[model samples]
Target: MERAMGISHFGAAAAACVFMLAQGARAEEAGPHLAIELNAVAPAETGCLISFMARNGHPAAIERAVFETVLIDRAGQVERLTLFDFGDLPAGRPRVRQFSIPGLACDDLGQILINGTSACEAGTLGEAACAEGLDLSSRTDVELIG
Candidate 1:
Protein backbone atom coordinates (compact mmCIF):
# COMPACT_ATOMS: atom_id res chain seq x y z
CA MET A 1 0.00 0.00 0.00
CA GLU A 2 2.76 2.42 0.87
CA ARG A 3 4.53 1.80 -2.38
CA ALA A 4 1.33 2.19 -4.36
CA MET A 5 0.51 5.48 -2.68
CA GLY A 6 3.98 6.78 -3.33
CA ILE A 7 3.71 5.84 -6.95
CA SER A 8 0.40 7.59 -7.25
CA HIS A 9 1.74 10.79 -5.80
CA PHE A 10 4.81 10.65 -7.96
CA GLY A 11 2.75 10.03 -11.05
CA ALA A 12 0.50 12.94 -10.24
CA ALA A 13 3.41 15.25 -9.71
CA ALA A 14 5.05 14.20 -12.92
CA ALA A 15 1.86 14.68 -14.86
CA ALA A 16 1.40 18.14 -13.40
CA CYS A 17 4.93 19.15 -14.31
CA VAL A 18 4.49 17.94 -17.84
CA PHE A 19 1.20 19.75 -18.18
CA MET A 20 2.65 23.00 -16.93
CA LEU A 21 5.57 22.75 -19.30
CA ALA A 22 3.24 22.05 -22.18
CA GLN A 23 1.11 25.06 -21.33
CA GLY A 24 4.24 27.16 -21.29
CA ALA A 25 4.40 26.82 -25.03
CA ARG A 26 0.97 28.15 -26.00
CA ALA A 27 0.17 31.15 -23.84
CA GLU A 28 -1.38 33.84 -26.06
CA GLU A 29 -0.20 37.09 -24.61
CA ALA A 30 -0.17 40.57 -26.07
CA GLY A 31 2.40 43.29 -26.45
CA PRO A 32 4.89 43.77 -23.60
CA HIS A 33 3.87 40.30 -22.41
CA LEU A 34 1.97 40.23 -19.13
CA ALA A 35 2.33 36.91 -17.39
CA ILE A 36 -1.19 35.48 -17.15
CA GLU A 37 -1.80 32.96 -14.48
CA LEU A 38 -5.17 31.31 -14.08
CA ASN A 39 -6.29 31.24 -10.47
CA ALA A 40 -8.90 28.57 -10.79
CA VAL A 41 -11.43 27.50 -13.43
CA ALA A 42 -14.65 25.66 -12.66
CA PRO A 43 -16.63 24.81 -15.77
CA ALA A 44 -18.98 22.69 -13.74
CA GLU A 45 -20.16 25.86 -12.04
CA THR A 46 -19.74 28.13 -15.05
CA GLY A 47 -17.28 30.28 -13.20
CA CYS A 48 -13.63 30.78 -12.40
CA LEU A 49 -11.50 32.07 -9.53
CA ILE A 50 -9.19 34.51 -11.28
CA SER A 51 -6.41 36.68 -9.97
CA PHE A 52 -4.25 39.10 -11.95
CA MET A 53 -0.57 39.91 -11.80
CA ALA A 54 1.99 41.91 -13.77
CA ARG A 55 4.82 40.14 -15.51
CA ASN A 56 7.86 41.31 -17.38
CA GLY A 57 8.98 37.88 -18.57
CA HIS A 58 11.67 37.97 -15.91
CA PRO A 59 9.44 38.10 -12.83
CA ALA A 60 8.51 41.72 -12.34
CA ALA A 61 5.84 43.27 -10.15
CA ILE A 62 2.84 44.10 -12.33
CA GLU A 63 -0.81 45.09 -11.89
CA ARG A 64 -3.79 43.27 -13.28
CA ALA A 65 -7.56 43.28 -13.37
CA VAL A 66 -9.63 42.69 -10.27
CA PHE A 67 -12.09 39.95 -11.01
CA GLU A 68 -14.89 38.96 -8.69
CA THR A 69 -15.65 35.35 -8.08
CA VAL A 70 -18.45 34.40 -10.49
CA LEU A 71 -20.67 31.68 -9.14
CA ILE A 72 -22.79 29.06 -10.86
CA ASP A 73 -25.61 27.24 -9.17
CA ARG A 74 -26.18 23.53 -9.46
CA ALA A 75 -28.99 24.09 -11.93
CA GLY A 76 -26.57 25.60 -14.48
CA GLN A 77 -28.21 28.97 -14.86
CA VAL A 78 -26.37 32.20 -15.55
CA GLU A 79 -27.38 35.48 -14.02
CA ARG A 80 -25.54 38.77 -14.07
CA LEU A 81 -22.49 37.97 -12.01
CA THR A 82 -20.22 40.87 -11.22
CA LEU A 83 -16.70 40.42 -10.00
CA PHE A 84 -15.06 43.77 -10.72
CA ASP A 85 -16.05 46.74 -12.83
CA PHE A 86 -13.54 48.70 -14.88
CA GLY A 87 -10.67 47.61 -12.70
CA ASP A 88 -7.01 47.96 -13.57
CA LEU A 89 -5.05 45.25 -15.28
CA PRO A 90 -1.42 44.34 -15.55
CA ALA A 91 0.93 45.59 -18.25
CA GLY A 92 0.45 44.98 -21.97
CA ARG A 93 -2.71 44.90 -24.07
CA PRO A 94 -5.52 42.45 -23.33
CA ARG A 95 -5.58 39.19 -25.22
CA VAL A 96 -7.16 35.77 -24.92
CA ARG A 97 -6.82 34.23 -21.49
CA GLN A 98 -7.35 30.51 -21.08
CA PHE A 99 -9.46 28.97 -18.33
CA SER A 100 -10.45 25.58 -16.99
CA ILE A 101 -14.07 24.65 -16.45
CA PRO A 102 -16.00 21.40 -16.47
CA GLY A 103 -19.15 20.74 -18.50
CA LEU A 104 -18.48 23.91 -20.47
CA ALA A 105 -16.99 22.46 -23.61
CA CYS A 106 -17.00 25.86 -25.32
CA ASP A 107 -18.93 29.05 -25.03
CA ASP A 108 -18.60 32.50 -26.50
CA LEU A 109 -17.75 35.31 -24.12
CA GLY A 110 -19.46 37.44 -26.77
CA GLN A 111 -17.00 40.35 -26.43
CA ILE A 112 -17.46 41.57 -22.83
CA LEU A 113 -19.04 44.73 -24.16
CA ILE A 114 -20.72 47.62 -22.44
CA ASN A 115 -21.71 50.74 -24.45
CA GLY A 116 -20.23 53.45 -26.63
CA THR A 117 -16.84 52.01 -25.81
CA SER A 118 -15.26 48.61 -26.15
CA ALA A 119 -12.62 49.45 -23.64
CA CYS A 120 -13.47 47.63 -20.48
CA GLU A 121 -10.36 48.98 -18.76
CA ALA A 122 -8.66 50.91 -21.47
CA GLY A 123 -6.86 53.33 -19.25
CA THR A 124 -4.82 50.52 -17.77
CA LEU A 125 -4.25 48.02 -20.59
CA GLY A 126 -5.33 50.10 -23.50
CA GLU A 127 -8.33 49.16 -25.70
CA ALA A 128 -9.27 45.52 -25.73
CA ALA A 129 -11.02 43.43 -28.36
CA CYS A 130 -14.47 43.14 -26.91
CA ALA A 131 -17.93 44.22 -27.95
CA GLU A 132 -19.55 47.32 -26.51
CA GLY A 133 -22.57 45.46 -25.19
CA LEU A 134 -20.75 42.61 -23.54
CA ASP A 135 -21.12 42.09 -19.85
CA LEU A 136 -17.69 41.20 -18.49
CA SER A 137 -19.43 40.27 -15.27
CA SER A 138 -21.18 37.39 -16.93
CA ARG A 139 -19.84 34.07 -18.12
CA THR A 140 -21.46 33.32 -21.47
CA ASP A 141 -20.13 29.79 -21.66
CA VAL A 142 -16.90 27.92 -21.06
CA GLU A 143 -15.70 24.46 -21.86
CA LEU A 144 -14.65 21.76 -19.51
CA ILE A 145 -10.95 20.95 -20.01
CA GLY A 146 -11.47 17.40 -18.94
Candidate 2:
Protein backbone atom coordinates (compact mmCIF):
# COMPACT_ATOMS: atom_id res chain seq x y z
CA MET A 1 0.00 0.00 0.00
CA GLU A 2 1.23 3.49 -0.77
CA ARG A 3 1.11 5.63 2.35
CA ALA A 4 0.84 9.33 1.76
CA MET A 5 -0.28 11.80 4.45
CA GLY A 6 -1.55 8.85 6.49
CA ILE A 7 -3.57 7.45 3.59
CA SER A 8 -2.73 4.04 2.17
CA HIS A 9 -3.31 2.69 -1.31
CA PHE A 10 -4.79 -0.85 -1.05
CA GLY A 11 -4.87 -2.00 -4.67
CA ALA A 12 -8.05 -3.47 -6.22
CA ALA A 13 -9.31 -4.60 -2.81
CA ALA A 14 -9.89 -0.95 -2.09
CA ALA A 15 -11.04 -0.20 -5.61
CA ALA A 16 -14.74 -0.24 -4.72
CA CYS A 17 -14.07 1.82 -1.62
CA VAL A 18 -12.19 4.35 -3.67
CA PHE A 19 -15.06 4.44 -6.12
CA MET A 20 -17.73 4.91 -3.46
CA LEU A 21 -15.74 7.28 -1.28
CA ALA A 22 -14.45 9.12 -4.35
CA GLN A 23 -17.31 9.10 -6.86
CA GLY A 24 -20.72 8.63 -5.26
CA ALA A 25 -20.98 12.08 -3.78
CA ARG A 26 -23.89 14.00 -5.35
CA ALA A 27 -26.94 13.18 -7.44
CA GLU A 28 -29.97 15.18 -8.56
CA GLU A 29 -31.66 15.08 -11.94
CA ALA A 30 -32.74 18.73 -11.82
CA GLY A 31 -34.67 20.41 -9.10
CA PRO A 32 -34.96 23.55 -7.00
CA HIS A 33 -34.31 21.89 -3.63
CA LEU A 34 -30.99 20.42 -4.73
CA ALA A 35 -29.24 20.05 -1.42
CA ILE A 36 -26.29 17.88 -0.22
CA GLU A 37 -23.93 17.48 2.72
CA LEU A 38 -20.59 18.16 1.05
CA ASN A 39 -17.49 16.71 2.70
CA ALA A 40 -14.62 17.61 0.32
CA VAL A 41 -14.98 18.84 -3.25
CA ALA A 42 -11.79 18.76 -5.32
CA PRO A 43 -10.60 18.43 -8.88
CA ALA A 44 -8.97 15.31 -10.37
CA GLU A 45 -7.31 14.45 -13.65
CA THR A 46 -10.48 13.09 -15.29
CA GLY A 47 -13.21 15.31 -13.85
CA CYS A 48 -14.00 16.31 -10.24
CA LEU A 49 -13.83 15.01 -6.69
CA ILE A 50 -16.93 15.43 -4.53
CA SER A 51 -17.00 13.74 -1.13
CA PHE A 52 -20.29 14.36 0.58
CA MET A 53 -22.71 12.97 3.15
CA ALA A 54 -26.23 12.90 1.91
CA ARG A 55 -28.63 14.44 4.40
CA ASN A 56 -30.22 11.08 3.63
CA GLY A 57 -27.58 8.50 4.57
CA HIS A 58 -26.39 5.60 2.36
CA PRO A 59 -25.57 1.94 2.89
CA ALA A 60 -22.09 0.60 3.65
CA ALA A 61 -22.11 -1.82 0.74
CA ILE A 62 -23.76 -1.73 -2.64
CA GLU A 63 -24.24 -3.94 -5.71
CA ARG A 64 -23.73 -1.50 -8.55
CA ALA A 65 -23.59 2.28 -8.67
CA VAL A 66 -23.32 5.16 -11.13
CA PHE A 67 -22.46 8.76 -10.39
CA GLU A 68 -24.15 11.63 -12.17
CA THR A 69 -22.36 14.96 -11.82
CA VAL A 70 -24.30 17.90 -13.10
CA LEU A 71 -22.65 21.20 -13.95
CA ILE A 72 -25.46 23.72 -13.69
CA ASP A 73 -25.13 26.87 -15.71
CA ARG A 74 -25.89 30.31 -14.39
CA ALA A 75 -29.08 30.13 -16.42
CA GLY A 76 -30.06 27.00 -14.42
CA GLN A 77 -29.59 24.61 -17.30
CA VAL A 78 -27.70 21.34 -17.11
CA GLU A 79 -24.37 22.20 -18.65
CA ARG A 80 -22.12 19.24 -17.85
CA LEU A 81 -22.93 15.69 -16.72
CA THR A 82 -20.41 12.90 -16.20
CA LEU A 83 -20.71 9.30 -15.07
CA PHE A 84 -18.44 6.90 -13.22
CA ASP A 85 -16.04 4.51 -14.93
CA PHE A 86 -16.50 1.61 -12.51
CA GLY A 87 -19.54 -0.68 -12.59
CA ASP A 88 -19.98 -2.65 -9.36
CA LEU A 89 -18.57 -3.81 -6.01
CA PRO A 90 -17.52 -7.07 -4.42
CA ALA A 91 -20.00 -9.05 -2.27
CA GLY A 92 -18.79 -7.70 1.05
CA ARG A 93 -18.70 -4.71 3.37
CA PRO A 94 -17.47 -1.52 1.75
CA ARG A 95 -15.36 1.20 3.36
CA VAL A 96 -17.83 3.96 2.62
CA ARG A 97 -21.09 4.81 4.34
CA GLN A 98 -20.96 8.18 2.66
CA PHE A 99 -20.24 9.15 -0.97
CA SER A 100 -17.30 10.44 -3.00
CA ILE A 101 -16.84 12.04 -6.42
CA PRO A 102 -13.47 12.23 -8.12
CA GLY A 103 -12.48 14.87 -10.68
CA LEU A 104 -14.49 17.64 -9.06
CA ALA A 105 -13.37 21.04 -7.80
CA CYS A 106 -12.85 20.72 -4.05
CA ASP A 107 -13.53 24.41 -3.49
CA ASP A 108 -16.28 25.23 -5.90
CA LEU A 109 -20.06 24.51 -6.05
CA GLY A 110 -21.16 27.37 -8.25
CA GLN A 111 -19.81 25.40 -11.20
CA ILE A 112 -21.82 22.17 -11.14
CA LEU A 113 -24.92 20.12 -10.30
CA ILE A 114 -24.79 16.51 -9.02
CA ASN A 115 -26.67 13.19 -8.48
CA GLY A 116 -26.22 9.36 -8.50
CA THR A 117 -27.48 6.10 -10.07
CA SER A 118 -28.07 3.10 -7.86
CA ALA A 119 -28.75 -0.45 -9.02
CA CYS A 120 -30.39 -1.27 -5.74
CA GLU A 121 -32.92 1.46 -5.27
CA ALA A 122 -35.04 -0.84 -3.16
CA GLY A 123 -34.67 -1.38 0.59
CA THR A 124 -32.84 1.90 0.60
CA LEU A 125 -32.66 3.14 4.19
CA GLY A 126 -33.66 6.79 4.14
CA GLU A 127 -31.17 7.64 1.39
CA ALA A 128 -29.59 4.22 1.02
CA ALA A 129 -29.93 1.89 -1.93
CA CYS A 130 -29.86 -1.84 -1.30
CA ALA A 131 -30.24 -4.81 -3.59
CA GLU A 132 -29.59 -8.58 -3.50
CA GLY A 133 -27.40 -8.42 -0.37
CA LEU A 134 -25.67 -5.14 -1.09
CA ASP A 135 -26.62 -2.04 0.88
CA LEU A 136 -26.60 1.61 -0.12
CA SER A 137 -27.88 4.03 2.52
CA SER A 138 -30.25 6.87 1.92
CA ARG A 139 -29.89 10.61 2.63
CA THR A 140 -28.92 11.29 6.26
CA ASP A 141 -25.28 12.25 6.49
CA VAL A 142 -23.80 14.30 9.33
CA GLU A 143 -20.77 15.67 7.50
CA LEU A 144 -21.15 17.43 4.18
CA ILE A 145 -18.09 16.66 1.99
CA GLY A 146 -18.29 18.77 -1.12
Candidate 3:
Protein backbone atom coordinates (compact mmCIF):
# COMPACT_ATOMS: atom_id res chain seq x y z
CA MET A 1 0.00 0.00 0.00
CA GLU A 2 2.88 2.42 0.76
CA ARG A 3 4.48 1.86 -2.67
CA ALA A 4 1.15 2.35 -4.44
CA MET A 5 0.55 5.68 -2.65
CA GLY A 6 4.03 6.97 -3.59
CA ILE A 7 3.42 6.13 -7.25
CA SER A 8 0.10 7.92 -7.22
CA HIS A 9 1.67 11.04 -5.74
CA PHE A 10 4.39 11.01 -8.37
CA GLY A 11 1.81 10.72 -11.15
CA ALA A 12 -0.15 13.65 -9.74
CA ALA A 13 2.97 15.81 -9.56
CA ALA A 14 3.88 14.97 -13.15
CA ALA A 15 0.41 15.88 -14.34
CA ALA A 16 0.63 19.19 -12.54
CA CYS A 17 3.95 19.95 -14.16
CA VAL A 18 2.56 19.14 -17.59
CA PHE A 19 -0.45 21.38 -17.00
CA MET A 20 1.77 24.26 -15.94
CA LEU A 21 3.97 23.87 -19.03
CA ALA A 22 0.96 23.88 -21.35
CA GLN A 23 -0.41 27.02 -19.73
CA GLY A 24 2.91 28.80 -20.14
CA ALA A 25 3.08 27.91 -23.81
CA ARG A 26 -0.44 29.18 -24.41
CA ALA A 27 0.34 32.44 -22.62
CA GLU A 28 3.35 33.03 -24.82
CA GLU A 29 1.35 32.35 -27.96
CA ALA A 30 -1.54 34.58 -26.98
CA GLY A 31 0.48 37.57 -25.83
CA PRO A 32 1.39 38.96 -29.22
CA HIS A 33 2.34 42.63 -29.41
CA LEU A 34 3.90 45.33 -31.59
CA ALA A 35 6.98 47.05 -30.17
CA ILE A 36 8.20 50.37 -31.57
CA GLU A 37 11.39 51.91 -30.26
CA LEU A 38 13.01 55.18 -31.10
CA ASN A 39 16.39 53.70 -31.93
CA ALA A 40 18.34 56.78 -33.02
CA VAL A 41 18.23 60.45 -33.90
CA ALA A 42 20.65 62.60 -35.86
CA PRO A 43 20.91 65.87 -37.67
CA ALA A 44 20.52 65.91 -41.41
CA GLU A 45 21.20 68.64 -43.85
CA THR A 46 17.49 69.14 -44.46
CA GLY A 47 16.41 68.59 -40.88
CA CYS A 48 16.33 65.90 -38.18
CA LEU A 49 16.62 62.22 -39.02
CA ILE A 50 14.73 59.88 -36.76
CA SER A 51 15.06 56.10 -36.77
CA PHE A 52 12.56 53.66 -35.38
CA MET A 53 13.06 49.99 -34.62
CA ALA A 54 9.79 48.14 -35.02
CA ARG A 55 9.07 44.56 -34.13
CA ASN A 56 5.92 42.61 -34.94
CA GLY A 57 5.11 39.75 -32.60
CA HIS A 58 1.81 38.97 -34.33
CA PRO A 59 1.25 35.78 -36.23
CA ALA A 60 0.28 37.66 -39.36
CA ALA A 61 2.38 40.14 -41.28
CA ILE A 62 1.53 43.81 -41.45
CA GLU A 63 1.66 45.01 -45.05
CA ARG A 64 1.53 48.68 -44.16
CA ALA A 65 1.73 50.51 -40.86
CA VAL A 66 1.16 54.24 -40.81
CA PHE A 67 1.16 56.22 -37.63
CA GLU A 68 -0.09 59.71 -36.82
CA THR A 69 3.08 61.09 -35.27
CA VAL A 70 3.52 64.30 -33.34
CA LEU A 71 6.81 66.04 -32.67
CA ILE A 72 6.96 68.11 -29.51
CA ASP A 73 9.44 70.90 -28.96
CA ARG A 74 11.55 71.50 -25.87
CA ALA A 75 8.98 74.06 -24.66
CA GLY A 76 6.30 71.29 -24.59
CA GLN A 77 4.66 72.67 -27.72
CA VAL A 78 3.60 70.72 -30.76
CA GLU A 79 6.20 71.26 -33.40
CA ARG A 80 4.92 69.10 -36.21
CA LEU A 81 2.21 66.56 -36.94
CA THR A 82 2.75 64.16 -39.78
CA LEU A 83 2.06 60.65 -40.97
CA PHE A 84 4.99 58.24 -40.95
CA ASP A 85 4.71 55.16 -43.11
CA PHE A 86 6.58 52.17 -41.72
CA GLY A 87 6.02 50.08 -44.84
CA ASP A 88 5.92 46.33 -44.14
CA LEU A 89 6.51 44.60 -40.85
CA PRO A 90 6.78 40.84 -41.11
CA ALA A 91 5.66 38.54 -38.33
CA GLY A 92 8.34 37.83 -35.71
CA ARG A 93 10.71 40.18 -37.51
CA PRO A 94 12.33 43.49 -36.64
CA ARG A 95 12.61 46.37 -39.09
CA VAL A 96 14.14 49.82 -38.93
CA ARG A 97 12.66 52.85 -40.60
CA GLN A 98 14.04 56.35 -40.80
CA PHE A 99 12.21 59.58 -41.43
CA SER A 100 13.54 63.06 -42.04
CA ILE A 101 11.66 66.06 -40.71
CA PRO A 102 12.51 69.08 -42.77
CA GLY A 103 13.16 72.31 -40.89
CA LEU A 104 13.19 70.55 -37.54
CA ALA A 105 16.39 70.39 -35.50
CA CYS A 106 17.19 67.20 -33.63
CA ASP A 107 18.43 69.07 -30.58
CA ASP A 108 15.19 71.08 -30.35
CA LEU A 109 13.02 67.97 -30.21
CA GLY A 110 11.67 66.92 -26.83
CA GLN A 111 9.20 64.10 -27.40
CA ILE A 112 7.74 61.86 -30.05
CA LEU A 113 4.13 60.85 -29.70
CA ILE A 114 2.38 58.12 -31.59
CA ASN A 115 -1.02 59.75 -31.57
CA GLY A 116 -2.87 56.93 -33.34
CA THR A 117 -2.73 54.37 -36.04
CA SER A 118 -3.48 56.05 -39.30
CA ALA A 119 -3.45 52.78 -41.24
CA CYS A 120 -2.63 49.13 -40.71
CA GLU A 121 -3.03 46.52 -43.42
CA ALA A 122 -2.83 42.98 -42.16
CA GLY A 123 -5.47 41.32 -44.30
CA THR A 124 -7.99 39.41 -42.15
CA LEU A 125 -6.15 40.54 -39.02
CA GLY A 126 -7.71 44.02 -39.48
CA GLU A 127 -6.29 47.50 -38.89
CA ALA A 128 -6.51 47.34 -35.10
CA ALA A 129 -4.00 44.54 -34.88
CA CYS A 130 -0.98 46.81 -35.07
CA ALA A 131 -2.16 49.40 -32.54
CA GLU A 132 -3.64 46.84 -30.17
CA GLY A 133 -1.13 45.73 -27.54
CA LEU A 134 1.29 48.38 -28.74
CA ASP A 135 4.56 48.88 -26.84
CA LEU A 136 6.74 51.98 -27.06
CA SER A 137 10.29 52.76 -25.90
CA SER A 138 13.10 55.13 -26.67
CA ARG A 139 16.89 54.76 -26.77
CA THR A 140 17.55 58.43 -27.29
CA ASP A 141 17.00 61.54 -25.21
CA VAL A 142 13.66 62.16 -26.87
CA GLU A 143 10.77 60.57 -25.02
CA LEU A 144 8.55 58.26 -27.05
CA ILE A 145 4.90 57.95 -26.07
CA GLY A 146 2.08 55.94 -27.56
Which candidate achieves the best TM-score against the true structure?
3
**What's the lDDT of the predicted structure labeled candidate 2?**
0.39
Total backbone clashes of model 2? Answer: 52
Candidates' TM-scores?
0.28, 0.33, 0.80
- Runs in model 3 lying further than 4 Å from the true structure: 1-30
At residue 96, candidate 1 shows an lDDT of: 43
Tens-digit lDDT string for candidate 1 (28-137): 22223333323233334554433222233312222333334343343455433444332443334443444333343233221221123322443433333222122233
**Winner by lDDT between candidate 2 and candidate 1:** 2
Candidate 3 local Cα displacement, residue 97, angstroms: 0.3
Cα lDDT tens digits, model 3, 44-123, are 99999999999998889999999999999989999989999999999999999999999999999999999999999988
lDDT of 1 at 49: 33
Candidates in order have lDDT scores of: 0.37, 0.39, 0.94
Instruction: Quantify how close model 2 is to the true structure by its C-alpha RMSD in Å.
Output: 15.7
Would you list the rank order by lDDT, best first?
A: 3, 2, 1
Query: Which candidate would rank higher by lDDT, 1 or 3?
Result: 3
The regions of model 1 sitting more than 4 angstroms off are 1-23, 28-71, 92-119, 123-125, 129-146
Task: Summarize candidate 2's per-residue lDDT along 16-50 as a digit string, tens digits.
Answer: 78777655453222211112334444566665555
